[model samples]
Target: MRREAMRHRLTEEFFARHSTVVAPDLIGKLLVVGECSGRITEVEAYSGADDAASHAYRGRSSRNDVMFGPAGHIYVYFTYGMHFCANVVTDTVGVANAVLLRAIEPIDGIEQMVNRRGRSDNLTNGPGKLCQALGLDRSDNGASLLSGEIGIYDDSWPDRSAGRAIVVSPRIGITRAVDFPWRWQLAAERNERNERRRPGGSRTP
Candidate 1:
């Protein structure tokens, strides 16, 4: 990808919808953070109030305050008294919705990721792992994605994922709201089912 051609980033409007919609559209998109970047492959959506699994389900707090602020912002949090997880804040201001970035196929800065994660294989196969590999933590919680080290990008205008099939499944790792079926991913590259979801709205070369 050309440096000038990749200048366009996913704007606030791209993430202004419910996380469920944004989640699937994110597949095949590039997630860039400073020198590290990757192609987003999997994500899961969570919303406020109705979603029992969401941190904002019990209303806002210091930890989840960013989720209700705006669109296209990072909503990072620590978990399991150990690893951190990164989420993309979605929907409009005052609406608590986010998409958990579950997995990515490394596209840039692999050596840095390997060093951070202590291994190359499966470096970003899970949410916690992805965050660790990307060096994201609670400190990045409220940063805007528009013009910073963190941004979701894509190829030239109108061009998209070649209509790759998006696999829909129930979200994992949470006991509550486990059957919402909001998890979305590209159908494993080589899978040959006709099922497809076309993504619209992206940066231009």
Candidate 2:
């Protein structure tokens, strides 16, 4: 299939739809950078106010305001005192919801992503790494993913039907509301590295 032609430039309504429906479905997808020709691999979803793990749990803020805007916009945030994390604003206007792009397998514009992230494989292996790999910062916050400079592509669909199931677990890197099972993961490639550091385990360096 012509990946680009089949691309569905999603809208806000797409985000507002049931997050559980969208979260795992986003696996095996592609996040493309129009200007830099970059592609990413991993993504995670956050439901609206009810989701204890969501930043929107407490309602909107100057930081999370973009998440309440029209869907298909970028919501970038600074964290860890050094890294910027990127998310796609989801749901209709006024509904604060988004999907955090946790990691990427790195497909194109690798050199640029490497330079921007200062590491090779690490460029898109974590939430912060994904932002760095895509050259995303606070400046990208609220940028439209359907137009302008950055966007998402639904070209690749992971093998959901394979015997392996999409891993649904708790959101990572949070201390409060740890009981909410709002996090989703795809362990198609179960390796020793991933096994050693299961979800809710010690922090990853």
Candidate 3:
């Protein structure tokens, strides 16, 4: 099951939608990078001109041009001068939308991640941290997820988080669009709240 899970790439249709729809749906999917993999735990959606928090809100720039590209691609960016944050570009050509990968639960290549970060706990609990742990940088920007060094896969379609339900809230650390409810994540506790709220609830195994 482990090997088979990483074989296919998610189709472009899976990402060619409004980021709000794609962000929450990305939870529990597997993000594969060569030998390293992790279950997507949290994401935040951003829209183009309509969203003041988005990089392309005002218009396109060299750094944000990737967001205007077709779906199923990455739009990595450097932030805070010392960290890189990874985002998945969504929507079709000419439309700018993306989902920031806020966190990931490690599923493979733990040793490499630990060695890169020099610690283990809370290694992938934030956008910058996950990028660091996953070895993502600006060079990975505009890469095609359908055929690139990185990709998001659905090895275990449903309940990949072992029955952990998904939760939604306003995006974090953003001044504008602070109350858009664009953030989605797999809740830590199991079966207490929001259970089976998502479409696929059955466990893969």
Predicted structure with the largest TM-score when compared to the true one: 3
How big is the positional error of residue 165 in model 3, measured in Å on the Cα after superposition? 1.3
Residue-level lDDT of model 3, residues 1-205, one tens digit each, is: 5677544578899999999999988998889887898888889999997999999999999999999999999999987889999999999999999999998888789899998788977778889998888899988999999986689887754345877778888887888878898989888654423222445554543
State the lDDT of candidate 1 residue by residue for 52-160, as single tens digits.
9999999999899999999999999998999999999999999999999998878789999999999867788889999999999888989999888899987553334
Model 3, position 21: C-alpha lDDT score: 92
Per-residue lDDT of 141 in model 2: 88
Query: What C-alpha lDDT do the candidate models reach, one value each?
Result: 0.86, 0.69, 0.86
Q: Model 2: what TM-score?
A: 0.80
Backbone clashes in model 2, listed as residue pairs: 12-71, 15-91, 16-91, 41-104
Ranking by TM-score: 3, 1, 2
Please give me the total number of clashing residue pairs in predicted model 1: 0
What are the C-alpha RMSDs, in order, of all predicted structures? 7.2, 4.5, 6.0
Error of 1 at 111 (Å): 0.7
How would you encode candidate 2's per-residue C-alpha lDDT over 10-76 as one tens digit per residue?
5545556655566666666667774443333345677767777778888888988898888778899
Off by over 4 Å in 3: 5-7, 157-162, 190-205
| Candidate structures ordered by lDDT, highest first | 3, 1, 2
